[model samples]
Target: MVMTQGWIKDNVQEGTPIKVARIYMKNATLAGDDLFIDNLFIGSDYDNYIRTSLPATPNGNFVYDVEVSKIDLGFDINFMAANCGHDFPLLGIKDATVLSGSAEPYSDIVVYGHPDFTAGTNMAVGRIVAATKPVTGSFELELNGKLVTVAADATAKKMKELVETNLDTGIVLVNQYGTCAGYAWDVEWASKGGNQPLIKVWCVV
Candidate 1:
């Protein structure tokens, strides 16, 4: 009998998310209140530069995110509702509940006070201090838990289709940066209704 390593394979071709770069944090003033990770306070007002804190349940202010003292959907609903198709890219943090093996989809992504997060590299499975967009520079994809400059043609197309259908249910979440409108591209999910072994992002159009 001959032993074969060829039989070994990975669950996902793109692999899983890895922490390549350290997270980038913004300096902030507490506005008369103390802050902690994932606290959802106004790190910079709703415009993403919270200086002072607003009410426990602030309304429509450019303050950080949410007023969930009343379970305010973190006020993220207001942001999404107000900014749905603006095409003006904003920063976001992955929700706390988004641990391994499951994702909360659109609701899982938030605008502010997400432990004061912003865009950068590395989507660690359970890191609250992390981001989801508009990386200050070009980004890469994860293949086998390692960052790759690009994905294979088949892998790129497959990741897009799988995540779109499974996570977004074929709904277009966001476009590939610097591309034409209506292009159906999306972000990576820790798990989109199932386990995805790697950090899959737009390596292809």
Candidate 2:
């Protein structure tokens, strides 16, 4: 037998290379049984809250583009806005879309007599993905793999553009192999030769 003592831990620590989440564990969100609150005066992504007016008919969830015309009520949400931010694109990924109900407003409206179990009359957005496709690009020396992430729900083409933009920006991200080494991708115009520019390769069984 052994004696036990109290201990503590934290999810994040500095200088330890906090790995960005890749394989997310499943959560209650999988059931899509999201929480709901109604009758609020107003909301916006500025404060991590999004505002929306109840449409004539609740269109359900997973909708990326919606035109909210009832702006007279002071609801500043424009789902159809270029990337949808009520005009605040500056927020980028921190905007309303980050929230679960960003697309499915009035999901479970009790005031409307709608039960709280149905997330929306639709499906949740799926991660844009590719299978068995060659990742085209010359890598720096041996760097090959890339962990790309897109905050908003968009087409596969759009996703590629965003990922490329992220790489071109030269933002230092902690890759699986290195830190701040930047994109090892080689370019015919200008780029340093890498170790075959292939960071990683895998065989699907």
Candidate 3:
């Protein structure tokens, strides 16, 4: 797993800019394999800047020299799974789930599922953070875990209503289906059910 934390410096001297600081886990083991850092960025009202690249050095760190000029600060972190590869069939299935109601079906859905069916699991983790003086705003976080399917009739309508109502104030929507796990119909059904992953929206009062 990857861990990251960022905050805006509030006590800078007049005319002195506040730089962004970031730390990442180096030489760490994730899901039984070595992990790699992909990219990092800091965003505010004025600008979004990418931090310097970490050089595969264990316990590596990077800092930005430019001062932050905006009141609301945001940070985004991304990482790649070390040994994961793409499963074309699974990708197609996921696309179908997301676009089930569209007028035209995505062509990618045609290539999913094979008789031999040998595909490795793909996993990704990411986080976005927004900072303020008193943190008086909202932030949205999306988590992908499991997937499921719902009946096209009343059950689907009820599920949609529950998701819209239960999602936190800052969260827009949490979606899952045929994406996280492999070509298992049960996985898809579980994600569509009420017991699957719950998205939490952050609201600072």
Candidate 4:
């Protein structure tokens, strides 16, 4: 096989300003393998910065930084509820039997304390902390777990109410789909059904 060699030379020293004048190839050749130039990084003094515990990019420009907590586009719930368009439709539970000292059949439904918990046999699950009804049709419930915190306190309280109220049930030991509203730590799992990936929030008008 015909072999070829490539070279890269840097003249700038550490802590010195660097500007690339030009890059060129020395002996142009044919009848050999093609030349490939991959991933080019300039002025990347990564190791020295780590060794000295200095800022990685002292001269880097700030492109943009965006921090978003919650967003609500008013939606018509009458239309949504009429068409069953609720992001998380309440799951109806019937004839549910709880085995003593067994992990609940759907521990991930609550999902605050048991983030990594998968449905298994004989695993202890979190307990319901509190349940309250905001309206005639909806309920919210809090279970044992870490609470999700957000930048806005009102948004956090609103979300807590939406989640806890949606799942709040008066029925003795019933399971249903719960919609978690607003920004939360565990909001990644907030959704319409069980055993599915979490989706972004949908608002009701």
Q: What TM-scores do the predictions have? A: 0.15, 0.16, 0.15, 0.14
Query: Stretches of candidate 1 above 4 Å error?
Result: 1-136, 150-194, 198-205
lDDT of 2 at 64: 38
Residue by residue across 71-151, what tens digits does model 1's lDDT show? Answer: 332322222221112222233345533233333333333223333455442333222322222222233555454444432
What shift in Å separates residue 36 of candidate 1 from its native position after superposition? 46
Write model 3 residue lDDT over 1-205, tens digit each, in one string: 1223324344554466665475444454322223444544344334444558544221121222223333344223322222322211111233322322222212222223333345642222112221111112223333353232232221223444444444322223323223222211111232343554654333333
Worst lDDT run of 10 residues, candidate 4, spans 75-84
> Per-prediction count of colliding residue pairs?
15, 11, 7, 10
Backbone clash pairs for candidate 4 read 75-205, 88-192, 91-177, 139-165, 139-166, 139-168, 140-164, 140-165, 140-168, 141-164
Clashes of 3: 7
Leading candidate by lDDT: 1
Q: What is the lDDT of every predicted structure here?
A: 0.34, 0.29, 0.31, 0.31
- State in Å the error of residue 33, model 3: 4.1
Task: Name the TM-score of candidate 2.
Answer: 0.16
Q: Rank the candidates by TM-score, best first.
A: 2, 3, 1, 4
> Which residue runs does candidate 4 get wrong by more than 4 Å?
1-11, 26-33, 46-205
Report the C-alpha lDDT of model 4 over 148-202, residue by residue, as the tens digit.
3222223333554554555332122212232322222344244334553232333
Candidate 2 colliding pairs, count: 11
> Which structure is stronger by lDDT: 1 or 3?
1
Give me the candidate number with maximum TM-score: 2
